[model samples]
Target: MSSTLLAKPQMRGLLGKRLRFHIFGAFAVSLGVVALYKFGVAEPRKRAYADYYKNFDATKEYEAMKQAGVFHCVRPRE
Candidate 1:
């Protein structure tokens, strides 16, 4: 029984070539996720917050809160 023909086929490349390809692929995927988060999630959230505060009047808000007695002074802890 000759076993020469039953051997697994070998790919033509350095062993490190396959490892490098896999490492680079994983790095690319991670970078893509970070970019997606920056553009898709963080950018929209930042814009929404900016829009919400764009026309805000801090003085008027404070005055209204004061008029409504919303603030109370607390004694310092000994």
Candidate 2:
């Protein structure tokens, strides 16, 4: 019996092409994840904080806390 279809230059070229494609695809995916986190996740949180603080009224709560003075205490570090 004889074996045929040994590794050839064309095969090597095809493998190289595929490797390049995979590397570039991985890089694109990483960049997309970072962009999503920066814009999609962080922006909404920032907007929510801004909106809450814009309409927040802390005066009544502060006055109540002052009258009660039952403040939460933090233990000193040893």
- The model with the greatest TM-score is 1
Residues 1-78, candidate 1, lDDT per residue (tens digit)? 686678866677767888899999999999999999999999999999999899999989887877677877633235
Q: Which digits, one per residue and each the tens of the lDDT, describe model 2 over residues 14-70?
A: 988998999999999999999999899999999999999998889776657756765
Question: Candidate 1: lDDT of 52?
Answer: 85
* Shift in Å, residue 60, candidate 2: 2.7
Question: Model 2 scores what on Cα lDDT?
Answer: 0.81
* lDDT at residue 6 of model 2 (Cα atoms): 62
> What do the candidate models score in CA lDDT, each in turn?
0.86, 0.81
